[model samples]
Structures are given as structure tokens and as C-alpha cells.
Target: MTPLLSWLTAVLVGVAPPPPGRTRELSTRDRELLAVCQTDQFRRVDVRIASIVEWRERRGRPYRTIPPDASLPEGHIAFTFDDGPDERATPKIRALLAACGVYGHFFIPGTRVGGPKARWAIAELKGLLAEGHIIGTHSATHPSFTRGVVTSRDRRRELDRGREALEATLDIHPVLFRLPYGEGHWDSEVLFEISRAGLVDLHWNITSDDAKDKAPKEPGFQGLTADEVLARIERSLDFSRRPGERLGHGVLVVHDTNYRIAALLPTLLNRLVTRGYTFVRFVGPLVEGRDAEEDTGVPRRD
Candidate 1:
């Protein structure tokens, strides 16, 4: 196998040895990303960083958010993947989720789902849906919707065009949407456009920090290692808990575009399950007033 693929396999199979001793460096962007994860503001379990229910109440936007389901027992969590379906990484992730008897919500860009260049990705999306996973639109070009970055007309196009492409190709209407980079998430106009599209906007309370660029072009952008990614996720899970709670329950975000996240998914899922967490989807039977245990066949832990 290629060295990169070999490393990924080793990680998944739990046989990879630690890397040899080498100098570690961080680029400005790398530091910035890491710093954001370390900040008190970023770590808070408030509307700005955590629960979608809190965001909906605070923002008072017309857009729909996932409501808190009392039917879902404590220790229930959902996995949401953004910026997929990657050619190599997505299938690996789907397999891992399937093996664990869980499903995930995938937010994919329209650009990756249409035309001849994306045939493989189209096939992957179909497989994911067939396997009981949920699909949502990320956007057409994966552009930031932050105010002034694009005109209002362009923002509408970004939302409409993405849902349109997916419908035309997959014949599936995705009711869920997520802002690229979570930018414009709180923007009024952006929320209006999303609401106007008849879609529900989804955000995460926990982040895996797996989206950092690992390319070697920059002087010191070594990006986060697999261990570091897992560590960040553990920290976020801890920070997401409320007072007097044994564990937190909410959406967790990761990127399928980053193959490393897929490689480490087995380890991550194992840890969560061992901690008595039940896996769930963001929508469908779990959140649609049905018992999660009956719908997903994933038993609730006491």
C-alpha cells in the first residue's frame, strides 16, 4: 500500500506505531486553529458554541433547529460530517459507522455531487443513503456566506443551487443545511435565505478539529496529529456537559474530507460507546418523535 494509505490503515486497525522522533512546528494558521479550540469562548457550552436549541431561542430566527427530544435518553449523541463525500475518505467512514451499527449525517457540497468528475462521489452518496445515513447540502461551491463575502442574490443561489443539484441527481430532497465553515450561521440574511428554502439549519456542539490543512507548502503548518485530533474531541465532549451531568449529549462535527478523521473514527466511536453513549442521527426517527432505541436498534445505556 502507499505510505499514506498504509498509515491510515494502521490507524484504523490499531497497529500503527508512534512516529519517529522529529521536530514539530506550527504555522500561524495552525496556531490560530489550535488557539480557537483552547479559548474560553470556544469551550463554553452556550448558544454560541453548543446547543442548537439555545441558538434558536436566542436568535429568534424563523429557521427551524433540532428541538431537544426528551424521548432520547441521556448520553445520546449524533455525528454530523461536513465537506464530503470525498473519493477515498467517505467510503471508509461509512464502513466504520456501519460496523459500529450507527448512522451519520453528511453535509456535502453540490460541486462534488454532479457531472462526470463526481461519479464516484455520487455512488458514495447513494450507498450512504441506502445504508440509512442522512444527507444534507453544504452549498454549491462551499463558499462562506459571511456578510459582504457574497451578495444576497449569490447567497440564495448558493443555497438553492445546492439543493437543486442534489435533487436533480439523487432524486432526494435534503431538508437539512449547514453553513460552510459555520460562517454566516448567525447572519440574519443568511438564516432568512435558508429558512426560505424550506430547510432546517444544523450546527454542532462538539467539534473534532479535523479540518486543519496539513499540506506542507507552508513553513510550519504541520497540522494536528491523529492523537491531537482525538484529544480535542475528548475535551469538547467534556466541555459540552451541563452542571451535574455525567456526560453531554448533542451533535458532534467532523469532516469526511479529512481522511485522518476516518482513520481514527473506529477509536473515537469505541471511546464514546464505552462511555455509555448511544449513537443517533440528527433527523429521521430519532428526532421525529420516535424512540431512538427502537428506530436505530442502538440500545440506551443506563
Candidate 2:
């Protein structure tokens, strides 16, 4: 083999091979191209340090980024529940959170948490907020903007209804919104609606994906056998986080209304508490106290 090629191979093998099917690794030719564009490593690190210093100076502290603030620290994971205020299930979700001495951000359907339903559940939500839990909106009905869930007009109506329901119930409305099914087809109208509603798009970094797996009678989940669901939730947590390390920040996307989640919440929260994480609600930057401006169109209450 040519000495030049041998050296190149050694350098490539020295660090670490990229994972299979991952295209992010530096290809030999691409890396060689970079040699012409190379900047000093120490200089790069210095630039990063300076950038962080300047950012901290202006923003006080940046959110959801590496080299987190000394105050916020790193490795803290936030728990956020979606599509809830489930009369039967939400109480249990709340109780588990209380027992753990940690609270989560709850994304509620405005209809469920409003009107007569609000009469019953809003009190519980108030207790949650009182205890530092956060509430965000998850649309008025559990409709989806995805092509599979419902028609476009129906989807718009659902969001519009949620906005009204939230305003009627909470009075302040919600400023945070998450898509149904943990994913959405983004477009100009979606962007316009989000902006007009004055809502921040709240989403998850970790989802159990158990909502799609409702077949408890099947192998993975079982009827009344909540352990299976609990186990999967645990596994999701494990896969999403590193143990004994400071994560500084992460958002765990979990469900409340799903019966399987009834068993899952307690165990995961307990495990998380034991891990030295203080459960903070994964609220976006536009919470009520964070704002002093007029309503933007999005419902602010969950």
C-alpha cells in the first residue's frame, strides 16, 4: 500500500468509525477538502468560549444548549405530559408527581379542561400549577394536522375550538402548542397560525411511542398489565439519557390518558428522582410571567 494512503487510513481509524447507516462521519475526500479550510483547534475552542461568555453576558443564561450555565447546571431532565386532564387518569398522574416531589408540564385538551369539565379538573390543575407544575395547550380536541388524522378544515376547526375553549376556561389562553402524534406536517399556514396564535411550538425530545401501541391484548402491552407499558417507558428514558452524567436538560414526552401510562408514571418518576434530577416543567420561553404583551392567537392554557 502507498505510505500516503496508509497514513490516511491510520488517521481515519484512529479516532472512531461513524455508526453504520449514519452519514455524518467525515469522508476521506471531504476531510481532505477540509484541510485547505482548516482553522486552528485551539483558536476554535477559544472562539467557542468567547461566544459562550458573550451570550451569557447578554441573555443571562442560554437554554437547551451544551456548556450550560453554572447556575442551571447540566443533565437535568424535565418531564412533560401531553393530551390530558383525563378525569380518571390525570389525578393518578398528578398524585404520582406529588409523591415524587417533582412536577411535570401537562398539555391539556382545552375542552376537557374547560366548561363543566373544567369545573372538576381545573381545580386539580390549579393544584398542579400551585406546586410549580406547568400547563400547555394540546389543541381543543385530540385532532391531528397530519394527513392521516383528519381533514384540513377539521384540523383548523379543532385548533380554533381549542383556542376558544382555552380562553373561556383559563381566561389567559395558552402560549405553548404541541402537535398531535408527536409529529406534524409543517407548512406556511401552520407557521402563520402558530405566529398569529402567539404560541411557541412545544415538542418532545423523547416520546414513549406507546400511544400507537394500544393493543394491550397483544404481546408488548396487555389488558390490565400495566407493567409492559411501564417497562417500555423506562426503556425510552434509558435510551434518551445517559446515567450518572449531567444532562443539564431534556424533555420526556409521556402520556396521561392512556391507561397503560397509569402504571408507567409512578415508576419512572421515582427512578428519575433517585437520579438527582429536579423535575422542572419543560415550559417554553413564552410563559405568562415571561410575557407582558397582548394575546397572539394561540391558547395559553392547557
Candidate 3:
């Protein structure tokens, strides 16, 4: 192995630190060496992977569920939007949620807020906060950390930069993070980075599959229609619930960047309400000590 690959292999196996004078940046040659490590031919290393939820539960910090009430017959259901702060779709989604009198958790990519559309993105994020929605980091540039292509330094940078950008801009310290593409949820390295950053990683048990791209000649040529998305969500809910359980609880994920989902959000929300599902916010280490019901309440916007 070359010195760089050897060093990386050692690092992956928990044996060594970065070589001297190579801590801050990778040289062109070093980049090529790293690329070699990312190839499919490269042998995958075995590391202790851990599920964040199980880890939290083991520590007695099990995520709290929003129980059913008289008005909402079904148990808790939290809505999470990823890969967003879109110029068009996001605002419409916010408006739709506002109309439905429910709040959502939006996981935004740091680059979107700090990039060229920083002004609009910042304003949009602020608006979401003002309207009582919760926001979390989705990482800077949304890289897939479990792919072996991401270095330790890259992981730290992704987590820290994304968090710092939001804190600096919003003057709020976010305690929640969701992995890009929902990858690395159980990777020890990824979990360590998240814990080191003092952020709890949130993973969804239910998904709308709204982010999925439709194949050529698919019914909804661009994306899945509202009915299709609803069907997928219902099926997931059915599978997750017990045989005799009347209500189900889970975090449902969608993308705010998808206009189809945004536009049809009301239909989904109404259907969910009619089906006795109560919209709730994620609660646990992410919002320690805060009641999910209180968190779900309307925010007092100035």
C-alpha cells in the first residue's frame, strides 16, 4: 500500500493518526490515493456499527411518542422534510402546513443556506422558525458518509460547518441532525462525529418516498403523485403497527425540494387527519426535557 492508503487503512482500523505535515489538507497525489481507497475493489473494513435509536434507548433516553388525544384519535406521527430550503417549494410547504395547523421538522443542507442564495435561504429558514417549525442540519453539501469515500476530517467538516453556519446565521444552536440520503445512521464514525458535535441524529421509520425519481414512462413521469405517496406512507404505517393497534407512530420523511410533494401536501395532511393520525414533532435527546405536545404547539411569533 502507498503511504496515504496505508495511513487511511490504519485510521479506519483505529490504529494510527494522520502522517506528519499532512493533517490539514490532502496533496494532489494524496487525493488520488484516497480515490483508490473509495473504489469497489478496495476491501471493506469491519467496524463497530451502532444504531442511534437503540443507543439512546439503552441510555434511557428513548424517544417519546405523542400520544393520542380526543381530537386526534391516532397516535403520534412526526413529519420531517429533507434536502431543502428551496426557493419555491419550501414556502409553499410552510404555507400548507400553516393552513393545516401543524408543524414540521425541516433538515436543511448547510450549503443551501450559506451559498449564493444565502439571503433567500436564510430568510426562508427564519420564516420556518418564526412559524413554529423545527430545523436541523442535513450536513454541508449532503455527502454520503457511509460510502467509505468520506474521510474523518471530511466528516467533521461536514457536521461542524453545517452546524456553525446555522448557528451563526440564526443565533440558535440546533440539537438535531439527519443524515443525507439517510446513510450512516448506524456507522460508529458517523455517530461519534454527531455525538462530538452535541447533536442527536434523527432517523425516519416511515417515508413518503416522495424523493424517489420516477422511471421513464412512469405514471407520474417526473415524480410520484399524491395518491402514490400516500399509499406508500399508509403501507409503511400498516407494517409498523401491531395487529390490533388502532394508531401508529413514526417519523415520516419527504423532501421540501420536491414541488409535487409540496403542492400536494394538504391532500396528504387532510387524509392523515381523517385517518386519525396526529401530527407531532420528534422528541428525545434532540429536545430533551421539552414535551412533544408543547413543541407541537403554535409558536408565539413576534
User: Which model scores highest in lDDT?
Assistant: 1
Q: What lDDT tens digits, residue by residue, belong to model 1 across residues 136-233?
A: 88889888888434786888888889987887777676767888988876566677677677565677778877767675332122347778888998
Q: Residues 214-267, candidate 3, lDDT per residue (tens digit)?
A: 743322223587679778888887665755787666677888776666546655
lDDT of 2 by residue, 120-225 (tens): 6766666666665666777777766665445546656666676667566655455556666654623434434543454545565555665665453332222334
Clashing pairs in 3: none
Estimate the Cα RMSD of every predicted model relative to the unseen true structure. 11.4, 20.2, 18.7
lDDT of 3: 0.63
lDDT: worst 10-residue window of model 1 = 41-50
TM-score of every prediction relative to native: 0.71, 0.60, 0.68
lDDT for model 2, please.
Answer: 0.51
Candidate 2: Cα lDDT at 114 = 54
In order, the Cα lDDT scores of the candidates are 0.65, 0.51, 0.63
Candidate order (TM-score): 1, 3, 2
Cα RMSD, model 3? 18.7
**Candidate 1 error regions (>4 Å):** 1-61, 66-73, 147-149, 216-223, 284-302
